[model samples]
Target: MKKQVCIIGGGPAGLLLGHLLTQEGVDCVVLERRTGDYVLGRIRAGVLEQVTVDLMKRLGLDERMKAEGLPHDGFNLADGERLIRIDIKELTGKEVMVYGQTELTRDLMEASAGRGLEVIYGAEDVELHDIDGANPHVTFTKDGSPRRVNCRFIAGCDGFHGPSRQAIPASVGKDFERVYPFGWLGILADVPPCNHELIYANHERGFALASMRSNTRSRYYIDVPLTEKIEDWSDERIWDELAIRLGPEAAAHITRGPSIEKSIAPLRSYVYAPMRHGSLLLCGDSAHIVPPTGAKGLNLAASDVYYAAEALSAFFGKNDADGIAAYSDKALARVWKSERFSWSLTRLMHRFPEDGDFERAMQVAELDYIASSRAAQTSIAENYVGLPV
Candidate 1:
C-alpha cells in the first residue's frame, strides 16, 4: 500500500498527527501493535496543557472532553499539615484540564473513525526501512500475513519501546536518560475527589498525590520503593499510607472505596536526541519521556506532533525543507525545558533515600520559596500550564 505518510503507533501522538495531515489533504496510515480496546484500556496521566487542548479543539475532538473534563485553576502542595496553593490561573491566566488519558484516547479514536481513518490494529513486528534515504516504507504482519506500506515519510509515534527510535543507527542518535529510584503506586476508585484540585504531598515517609478523573472517580498515588510488590499492597494499606503522607487536613477529605485499578509506574526522564533522521521522525514517547510528576509526558508529545506537522505541511506544500530540517532542534528546545521541570518536580516532592540533611533542607527551602514568592509560583505555573505551542 502507498500513502503520503506512514505513522507507526496509533496512540494519541500518531493519531493526532494523522488527523492534522488528513485535514491538510495529506493522506497517511497508522499502524498499532495492539487492539484498539487494549490501547484505550491502558491507564495514563490526564492533565492537559493548553497546547494539547487547543490542538484537540482544532481537530474538533474537544466536545466530549470540554464537557466532561474538569478544569482546575490551581492545585495544592502539602508540607506536613499545611497546604500551599499554587494559583495557576490567577498567576498566569491559564489553567489545566483534568481528564483521563483513556477518555482522551477514546475521543481521538472516535474522531479518527468519524473521519474514516486508515489504521491497522494488531500489527506485529512492525519495522521501518530506508528512513535515512529519500523514501521510507514500513513492514509488519497481520494475522500471520506480511504487509507493507510505502510512504514519502515515516512518523515514529510509538512509545519508547517501539522500533522507530532504534531504526536510527546508534552512530547517529543518542539516548539520555535518568531513572528515578522510586515508583508511584496508584489506585483508581469510584469516589469523590479528596479535593477539586490535585494535591501533591511531600512527606517524611515519601511523596503522595491526590488526583481525579472526574468528580466521582478518584485517582491517588504514593511513592513506594522498587522492592515493594504490588501484590502486597491491599486497598486498605494504600489509603492508610496516603492519609499519613497527605497529612491530616487533606486526609480528612478522602472518600475511601474499593479500588478498580492498581498499578506501579516507575518515574524517569528520557530523551532520544535529533528526533529525526532522514525521512524518519520520532514523536512523543518514541523520542522522549518525562516523569509523570510534572504532567508533561503527553503534552510534550503533542508539542512534538505540532512541530512535525508544521514542518511536514510546509515541506509538502511549498517544497520547503527548512521546517523539516529544523524540526529536531525546535522540538528538543522545548523538550529539554519540560525535562527540567519534571525533574525538578520529582526532586522537590520525593524523599530520596540518599538525601542528606542538607539536601532535605534545600527541598524544604525551595518549597517554602515557591509558596511565598509570587515569582517562583509563576515560574511553576507557566511550566505546569505549559510554555507555548
Candidate 2:
C-alpha cells in the first residue's frame, strides 16, 4: 500500500484525522490493532468542547450529534455544603455538548467507506520505520500475511500504550508525567442523571462526579485508592457512596439501577515533547494525556488533529512545509494549558491521602473564594468550556 499518510490507531483521533485528510484530497490510510466493535466498546469521556464539535461540523458529521447531544450552559461544583454553579455560557459565551466519544467515533468510522477514508482494523504488531528520513513506512500483519504501507508521513494517533511514541528514539523525546494516587471507580446505569447538568463533588470522604451520556444513561464516579478492586464495589454500594458524597439535594433525585458497565480507571497527566519528529507526528494520547477532571482528553485530540490536518493539507495541497514545521509548537501550547487546567481541577476536587489538615483548609478556602468571586468563576468557566483553539 502507498499513501500520503499512514495513521496508526483507528480510534477517534486517527479516524478524525483520516477523514479530514481525505476531505482535503490527501490520500491516507488508518491502521487499527482492534476490531471496530472493541474500539466502540471502550467507555470514555462524553463532554465536547467547541473545537471538537466544530471539527465534526466542518466535516459534515454533526447531524446526529446536534440532534441527540445535550447542550449544557453550566456545571456544578460541590463543596459538601452547596453547589457552586459555573455558568459557562454567561461567563464564556460558550456551551459544551454532552455526547459520548463512542458515538462520535462511530460517526467517523461509518462515514469512512462512503467518503473513501481507508481504515484497516485488527492490524497486528504495527511498527514504524525511517520516521526521521524524508520517507516513512508502516508495517504490520493483516490476518496471516505481512503488509506494509509506504507513505510520506506517519501519524501516531494510538493511545498511551501503543507503540508509535516508543518508535521515536528515547534521546529525541522528553516526557513529563504525574500519576495520581487514586483511580475513579465508575458505574454506567440506564437511569436518568441526578441533575440536569454535570457535577463534580468534593466531599469529606473523597471525590465524585455526576454526569450522563444522555437523559436516560447516567454515568457516575467516585475516587478510590489505587489498591481498590472493581469486584468489591456493588451497584448499591456505589449509589450509597454517591448519595453521601454528592450532598442531599442532588441525591434526592438519584435513580438507582444495576450497572451496565463498571470499572476503575487510573488518573494521570502526561505529555511528550516535540509531537512531531521528522515525518512522524504524534496525536492525542500518543503525545499527551490529561486527567479526566477537565474532560480534555478527546477534545485535546481533536485540536491536535485539527492542527495536523491543516499542516498535512498545506504540505500536500500547496507544497508548503511551514505548517508541518510549526505543528508541534502550536499543538503543545494548547496541550500544556489543558494539562494545567486538568491538574488544577483534579487537585481541588480530590482528597489526597498525603494531604494534611492545612491542605484541606486551603481547599475549603479556595472553594469559598470561588463561590463569592465572579472572576474566579469566569476563569473556571472559560477553561471548562475550553480555551480558544
Candidate 3:
C-alpha cells in the first residue's frame, strides 16, 4: 500500500513538504484556508539564511530566487553617529539573501501546480481526525461542501493560529511564551532603499530598520509601543522619526513615497514541546515562533518542513521512525537556539520605555561585548547567516 500524507496550511512548510514528498513518490494533499493570491501577497520575512538558500538550490527552487533576490553580505548596526558593519561573509563565510517569503511561496505554488498534487485553497472547517491512530485524516469544507482526506500521516504547518496545534493533548505538551512590551510597525514604500545593506539603528527614540524588498521597492520598520495606532502615524511623522533614527548619513537617500502597506507585528517567543502526536506531526509556526529580530521566522519554517520531509521519507520507504520520533527534538535544537539569539538581539537594539538604569547599562555592555569579541561576533555571524540543517 502506498503511504499518503495530508499537509495542512500551504505556507512554506506545507508546500515544500508536498513538493518533497511528491519527488519521493509519496501521495500528498495540501489544504490551505487562504486563497493563493492572499498567501502570495502577504508581506513577511525577507531574509533567507544560508542553509535555506542551499536547500532551495538543492531542491531546484533557487532559479527565481537567485534571479530576483538581493544578496546581502552583512547589515549595519548604527549607534546614532557611528555605524558598525557586521560582515557576515567575513565572519561566517556565508551570505544571507533578501528574498521575501511571499516570493518563495509563489515559486513553490507555481512549481506544485499540475503535479497531480491536491492543493485546496479557501478551505474552511479544517480539522484533524484520528491523530493518534495510524491513519490520520484532514476534514474540511470547500465551496460549502464537506470533504474528508484520509492519509497515512498528517503534517501540521498551519501557523500559530491554525487548528493543528490544538490537536495535541494539552497534558502532553508544555507551552512556553514571552510577549515583548513593543511591536514593529512595518511599512513598504514605492521608493528605493536608502542603503545597500540593512541598517539596524538604536537611538533614544526607539529602534528603526531600513531594508529593501526589491531594487525599486523598500521595506522599513520602527519599534513602536504596542498600543500605538497606525492611523496616528502620518507620513510626516514617520519620515521625521526615520530620519532621526537612521541619522543624517542616510537622510539624503531617504525619499518620500506612498506608504502602500503598514501594520504592527507583536514581538513574541513561543514554543510547544513534543511536536508529534502519533501519526500527526507539526512544523513551522505551528510548532514554534520567534521574534523577527533575527530574521529566523520564515527560514526556520522552511527548516522544519525540510526535516519533516526527510523523516517521512525514511519512515515510509525504509520502515524507519527514528527520524520521525526525533523530529521535534531535532527541530527544537535549532529553534531554541534561534529563540535565544532573537531575544538577545531584540533586547540589545530595542529600547524599553520602562527599562531601569541597570537594564540600559546591561544592553550597552552586551553590544560592546558583541562588537569587541571575536567569539561573540562569530556567534552572531553564524546564527545570522544560518546554521547547517
Candidate 4:
C-alpha cells in the first residue's frame, strides 16, 4: 500500500486526523491493533473543550453531539462544607460539552467510509521503519499475511502503550512523567447525576467526582489507593462513599443503581518532548497524558490532531513544509499549559498519603480564597473551559 500518510491507531485521534486530511484531499490510511468494538468499549473522559467540539463541527460530525450532548455553563468545586461553582460561561464566555469520548469516536469511525478515510482494524505487530528519513513506511500483519505501507509521513496516535512512540529512538526522545499515588475507582450507572453539573470534591476521606454522560447515565469516581482492588468495591459501597465525600446536598439527590461499568484507573501526567521526529508525528497519548483531573485527555488529543492535520495538509496540498517544521513547538506550547492545569487540579482535589496537616491547611486556605475571590474563580473557570487552541 502507498499513501501520503499512514496513521497508526484508529482511535479518535487517528480517525479524526484521517478525516481532516481526506477533506483536504490528502491520501491517508489508519491502522488499528484492535477491533472497532474493542476501541469503543474503552471508557474515557466526557468533557469536550471548544477545540475538540470545533474539530467535530468542522468535519460535519457534530449532529448527534449537539443533539445528545449536555452543555454546562459551570461546574462545582467542593471543599467538604460548600460548593464553589465556577461559572465558565460568565468568566470565559465559553462552555464545555459533556459527551462521552466513546460516542465521539463512534461518530468519527462511522463517518470514515463516507468521508473516504480508510481504516484498518485488528492490525497486528505494527512497526514503523525509516522514520528519521524522508520516506517512512509501516509494516504489520493483517490476517496471516504481512502488509507494508509506504508513506511520506506517519502519525503516532496509537496511544501511550502503542508502538509508535516506542519506535522513536531513546536518543531522539525524552520522557517527563509523574505517576500519582492513587487511582480513580469509577462507576457508571443508569441514573440521573447527583447534580445538573459536574463536581470535583475534596473531602476528609479523599477526592471524588460527580459527573454524567447524559441525563440518565451517571458517572462518578472516588480516589483510592493504587493498591485498591475493584473486586472489593461493591455498588452500594461506592455509592455510600460518594455520599460521604460529596457532602450532604449532593448525596440527597443521589440515585443508586447497578453499575453498567466499573473499573480502577491509575492516574499519571506524562509528556514526551518533540512530538515530531522526522516523518513521524506523535498525537494524543503517544505524546502526552494528563491526570484526567481536568478532563484534558481526549481534548488534548484533538488539539494535537488539529495541528498535525494542518501541517500535513500544508505539506501535501500546498507543498509547504513550514507547518510541519513548527508543529512540535506550537503543539507543545499548548500541551504544557494543559498539563499544568491538570496537575494543579489534581493536587488541589486529591489527598496525598504523604501530605501533612500543613498541606491540608494550605488546601483549605486555597479553597477559601477561591470561594471568596472572583478572580480565583475566573482563573479556574477559564482553565476548566479550556484555553485557546
Q: What are the RMSD figures for all models against the true structure?
A: 0.8, 0.6, 1.6, 0.6
Q: Could you give candidate 4's per-residue lDDT for residues 44-125 as a string of tens digits?
A: 8899999999999999999999999999999999987799999999988999999999999999999998888999998999
- Candidate 1, position 134, lDDT: 86
Write model 2 residue lDDT over 1-389, tens digit each, in one string. 99999999999999999999999999999999999999999899999999999999999999999999999999999987799999999999999999999999999999999999999998999999999999899999999799999999999999999989999999998999999999999999999999999999999999999999999999999999999999999999999999999999899999999999999999999999999999999999999999999799999999999999999999999999999999999999999999999999999999999999999999999999999999999999999988887
Model 2: lDDT of residue 317? 98
Q: What TM-score, over all chains together, does every model reach?
A: 0.99, 0.99, 0.97, 0.99
lDDT, candidate 4, residue 60?
A: 95
Instruction: Look at candidate 2 and tell me the lDDT of residue 186.
Output: 97
lDDT of 4 at 150: 99
Error of 3 at 104 (Å): 0.7
Q: How big is the positional error of residue 319 in model 3, measured in Å on the Cα after superposition?
A: 1.6
- What's the true lDDT of residue 282 in model 4? 95
Q: Any runs in candidate 1 off by more than 4 Å, and if so which?
A: none
Model 1 agreement with the true structure over 1-389: per-residue lDDT tens digits = 99989999999899999998888778889999999999998988999999999989998889999899999899988987789999999999999999888888888888787797788899999989999898889999999999999999999999999999989998998889999999999999999998899999999999999999999999999999988999999999999999999999989999999999999998889999999999998899999988899789999999999999999888888888999999999999999999999999999999898999999999899988988999999998999999986
The predicted structure with the larger lDDT, 1 or 3, is: 1
* TM-score-superior candidate, 2 or 3: 2
Model with the higher TM-score, candidate 1 or 2: 2
TM-score of 3: 0.97
Where does model 4 exceed 4 Å of error? Answer: none
